[model samples]
Target: MNRMPVEPPRIPRRNTGVTPSPPFRDRLMALSTNLRPAAWTRSGIAGGATIALFGWLLACAGAAGGADEVRAGAQDYRLSGEFGLSVHQVGDSIVVRWMTDALVEGSLEVTTGAGDVVHRDATEAWTSHRSAFATPAEDSIQLHYGDADARHRTWIHLAERDPRPVRITGVDSLFVMADIHGEYDQMVGILQNAGLIDEELRWTGGERHLVALGDMMSRGAEVTPVLWFLYRLEREAEASGGRVHIVLGNHEIMVMLSDLRYVHYREMWLATSYGLGYDRMFDPRESILGRWLTEAPAMLQVDDILLAHGGVSSDQLAFTVESHRDTLAAYMAEDLFHRWGDTTAFFDIDSITFNRRVDFFWGDRSVFWYRGYSDSDTLTAELDSVLEHFDSRIHVMGHTPVPGIREVYDGRMILANPLPLGDEILLLVRSEEEGRWRGERFRAEGPPLPLEVGHPEG
Candidate 1:
């Protein structure tokens, strides 16, 4: 009997203003062996009808993951309590805060790197515990809760805000992946296969920078896990001399503005269960991951490549790297934080839209949302203009999902979005001899393949 080929079930994609991904453009691997990462093909694979139906059913069930964890968390907040905490080290004091159902005040035990524990009696400062520790922890910090009968611990630490570089001059090797969209397992698998991270999701890439072109949230069950992984991965990458650059995407902005349309049911249920609407769950002013979102750049240049969520537009060709970072959307973040700047500020989506019409950043042509690069009508000259303005050879962007990894204008533009994990990730390395970054694609448990694999147009 011949085996069957099956396309993955169609999950709804985030609103990109363009036609959404088709119901079954990409097929799936069997649930038994799990993510073998089916090699994408134009011709359908030969298989039995029964197997195809089985694959489709498996794909549909994949989206509802994390049910047990969500249920356990609903029963006891401690199970999911780490997400509610945010730690920031100020001038001489480290400020700690957490989201709680009711006013919470208790003893906050701090454990430093040297194995010393300092006990501080925390006082309620609104909805969560607020404490300013005189000791500065640039590395690991453990927060202890509960009494002798039962002990609970949540480890928290954030490296200094030295990330978000607009331009990086020298870098030999770089790993580029785009539009994670909460596919945490695939993200981990692909990165681990590339030798960028270990099985534990710790960065072992060593001086090798990792670039995420954005859309790290919404659409799947592992949204929180992905964010949290990247959060720690960023810090670990920095400590190992590698930097993790995260470019802002439309879905991330949508979450910040409480536009929760494309988010997975698991995350939505958690927010509702905790009474944290979308914004409060990942609020830019609170939630450690939410705070990191504001610091992420909309676009940046590394060596000869320009990385952006959506490729830059014609008018934006005149915008500088810093200007790209200071779009009105970014301004809205600071303004809203100062004006309302409280936990109660979320829940109101209307007040957070920030005049999307007038702001060029939120406009269709802006960096965070533009999709012109994917259209064949987009002139090569316009792309060349972008290259000349930024003095970069290639534009690496995500937003418009290419079937896999696509190279247009004979390799001047690459669109890698919403990593389906089918085609896996694209790796670009700086070639000192050629004096330009070269591109290649990598799939699950296999050697690197030619860039041509992703470009069927050839």
Candidate 2:
């Protein structure tokens, strides 16, 4: 008698906070095992796909000249080239079919409007199906075929003209996330459920901003997607007159200087496991990430609220934009190989020492380092001094991962670590009154498991 094959159980949507089943673990292991044999096979398939796609693209390019085309504007152009290929949107999937005019050998490049390269296929017979995600901001998609004599390209806009301003009149709310550690999917789910991001991944808040207290990279498997999502969100928010503040965290500095050997072996393991290639991945020549990181401010002021990663030092008590900028510049110029390299303002090796009364950036010790210390009093004093200097009553930070939202110094400083048990935890900051901001903590309660930490340095 023949037996039917067992189907792998489906993993429930993570938003419900339901613990993943043991079968899910088994399934993941099985999938990984199955992938090993097909690794080279897939590479070959990708190569074939690339060639096919580019070949078809070139054929389309040949026909581009004869299509009913219009130069919409300086930046906006449309061409409906004639091709034997069929292009149509069925439900949420875009089905594209075309025959290659001539056998071509190369890769295909799809460039997005924000200057981001999306799909790079290096296979023969390129064919792919992508979901049609709604885009709120003005965006364009470009298809590039061949290296030389290969100028085949198509651009399409995926946004409505004159989009309505994000409605935040009664919202008066802000979302605060910390220690995301490369959990892009979870973060997006939380934001979408909370109404911070629309279904199309566009910002929906008016006059409100989302404050991420830092540590965005260095863990989880999908750091690239996480950063890309945030980058898009920042642009969308700015377009809608809202804002997104990404505070610099200690881990960020570690990832930035990973090439200089400032990061640890374990952190490097985390980076590699999560697909973060520190040295070879980020190109110092282009320096996009470096430029973005250098521009990130140490502290951001929203109404009367002060937001920062790690914490503030005593010297930064009266911190201004100019002062922080100068300090950051000085720190960036330091040589990591030197003895005094770690002592720079930007390099905080001893997290505990940061919040010390005399040392500055007061706290018990380096929170990430986790040295034994019970100097809460000194930390409180330093916090008071900072509050007085800034003239702000509340200071919010996310360096230490607390079990839940912790109110230290009688609510003067809030320690918000949204990655409790390496699961999902995010804080919401809402404007209760004209000038008052309230911090609300949300936690996903379920089974406990070790979170994979990705440190790109390794």
Highest-lDDT candidate: 1
| Alpha-carbon RMSD of each model | 13.4, 18.7
Model 1 quality (TM-score): 0.69
Candidates in order have lDDT scores of: 0.62, 0.45
lDDT of 1 at 173: 82
Candidate 1, poorest ten consecutive residues by summed lDDT = 2-11
Q: What lDDT tens digits, residue by residue, belong to model 1 across residues 146-188?
A: 3222234656655546546779878888777888887777888
The C-alpha stretches of model 2 lying farther than 4 A from their native spots are 1-107, 110-172, 259-277, 283-285, 333-378, 421-434, 443-458
Would you give me the overall lDDT of model 1?
Answer: 0.62
Q: What lDDT score goes with residue 41 in model 2?
A: 28
Worst 10 residues of 2 by lDDT: 70-79
TM-score of 2: 0.52
